[model samples]
Target: MREFSEDYLRRTRRGMWDDSREALAPLALESRSRILDVGCGTGELSRVLAAESPSGAEVVGCDADSALLEVAADCVPVVAGDAYELPFPDDAFDLVVCQALLINLPDPEAALAEFARVSSDLVAAVEPNNAAVSVDSSVDAEGDLERRARRAYLDGVETDVALGADARAAFEATPLEVLETRRYDHVRTVEPPYDEGAVVAARRKATGAGLADDRETMLSGGLTEGEYDDLRSEWRQMGRDVVEQMEAREYEREETVPFFVTVGHV
Candidate 1:
């Protein structure tokens, strides 16, 4: 499983579940008695599930990270557990769900089987199609460099990162039958009145302070050292331009990530 910090999880998942009610409606979660959210980190999705479900529904969150579970416990009932082996009885949940969990797993099909085993009614997966991400930035080089970097990162990923585009195959491998599929577009924007984190991130990019962290992964993914050096120089310049625009209060960027909500019935 992949490890994530509380800050990273919060930043990436911001505004994800805000407008996802339509995509989540097929499962009829309002009537569910027991809703289990596997691999729940920071309880973002679990909070939404709890709000959508009936008053008596037990919307629980489970994760392998104790620290994250501790944070999640404040929002919902959280348990320390792994997705491959949930610490619950068979047919223990009327609905089993996970948000952005399967794409990072080594064997998503096996996890889906476990989800099916624990769910008696519906199983849902909310995952992103990383390959189809689109970016529109005020700085042209920023968009281009981001595409190049994303390509390198995708190549270096050992797991099936594009699983959201073809998740039906995983369901076919399991005992559950596919019931519905819905598409959700998550749009992340950085504009005027930038937050403290965005300002800090732009400054880091301008100084190339964060480029070194991904250097090893890019090198292994066919990005030569010389090419990386050149990209860093350009990235720094673009970041500087962004800073200038920010000073003028004219910086804006929008990135759209397509996600799929696949619902399966046992």
Candidate 2:
């Protein structure tokens, strides 16, 4: 499984559940007695689950990364465990859910089966369709360039990162019965009066550091060395353009990632 840093999770998941949570209706969190947030990195969704559920409801986060669990421990009780072999007993939670977890797992079906084993009532997954993501930017080339890079990354990724609405299949393959699926768009924006994180991101782009991190993956996806170098050069130039625009407070970017909430009954 892939691991993420705390800063990465925080930046990516910022303001996730802040706007509206109508898509979470299928989880029926209000009446849930116990909820388990599997693969709960930094407890983003876990915190949401706790706030939405009943006052006395138990919202426990479980992750293999002890460091992340330590951070999550601040909001709710946490357990150090793997997704395939959860540490809890059968029927330990009324609702078992994971956010942005299935896309990274090699065998999401196996994980779903395990989730059903621990949940007596419902199991849910909030996964993104990376292929369907949309980017709008003040810089014309930024959107297209991002799409190209995203395509290469998706091709190179071993797991099904684009498994959004199709998560129903995984749930149906398990003993659980498919309930419903809803779509939620997680939008992240960058505009005038740039924050510290946005400034750092622009700097990384100017240096091609972001693309450098994915160099191995792009190569695995069949990008030749020369092609990769050319792309990186262009990416850095675009980053420079972004930095220039930011200096004038003319830089603005909006990225929308489509996430599907699939709920199933045990």
Candidate 3:
């Protein structure tokens, strides 16, 4: 499984459930008595689940990372455990769900099986279709460059990072009965009155820090060293353009990541 830093989780999941949560309707949170959020990371979705569910509902977060669990503990009850082997008895929860978790696992089906074992009623996954991501930016080249970089990353990544609506296949492989799938677009926007994080992101782009972090994955995906250099060169140039636009307070960008909420009955 892949690991993520607390900062990465926070940045990517910022404002996720803030706008609307109609897609979460399938989870039927109001009546849920016990909910377990697998691979909860910093507990963004765990917090949301807790808030949306009935006041007395028990919401627990489980993760392999102890450090992340420490952070998540601030929000809800947390346990350090692997996704495939949860540290709980069978039928421990009424609803077992994960967000952006299955995409990083080599065997999502296996994990779903475990989720079914633990959940007496529901199993849900909230995964993104990375390939379907759309970006619009004031900097004309930014959108195209982002797509190119994403394509390379997806091609090279080991896990099925693009597992979105297709999560039904994995659920079908388990004992759980397939339920409904809902599409939710998580939009991240950067416009005037840029926040501190936005400014720092521009700086990271200027230094190609983000691309550098994915350099190994891009290379493993068949991107040659020379090709990577050329791409990074262009990427840095684009970043500089973004920085310039930010300086003028004219930078605007909206990135839409389509997430599929797949729910199943165990």
Worst 10 residues of 3 by lDDT: 49-58
The lDDT of each candidate is 0.87, 0.91, 0.93
Number of the top lDDT candidate: 3
**Clash pairs (backbone) in predicted model 2:** none
For model 2, state the Cα shift of residue 221 in Å: 1.0
- lDDT per residue (tens digit) for residues 1-266 in model 1: 66888987887876776754677787687689999999899998988888887656999999999998898899899889989999999999999999889999999999999999999899999889998898899987888988877888777777888899888888889998998788878888889899987898789879976677677777888888898899889878988998998888998989999989999999
Q: lDDT by residue for model 2 over 75-193, one digit each (tens)?
A: 99999999999999999999999999999999999999999999999999999988899999998889999998998877788999889869998888888899898888888889989
Pick the winner on lDDT between candidates 2 and 3. Answer: 3
Candidate 2 deviation (Cα RMSD): 1.0
Note each model's CA RMSD in angstroms. Answer: 1.5, 1.0, 0.8
TM-score-best of 1 and 3: 3
lDDT of 3 by residue, 134-200 (tens): 9999999999999999999998988998899699888888888988988999999999999999999
- Give me candidate 3's TM-score against the actual structure: 0.98
Query: Of the pair 1 and 3, which is ahead by lDDT?
Result: 3
Deviation in Å, model 3, residue 75 alpha carbon: 0.7
Q: In terms of lDDT, which candidate is stronger, 1 or 2? A: 2
Give the TM-scores of the predictions, in the order they appear.
0.95, 0.97, 0.98
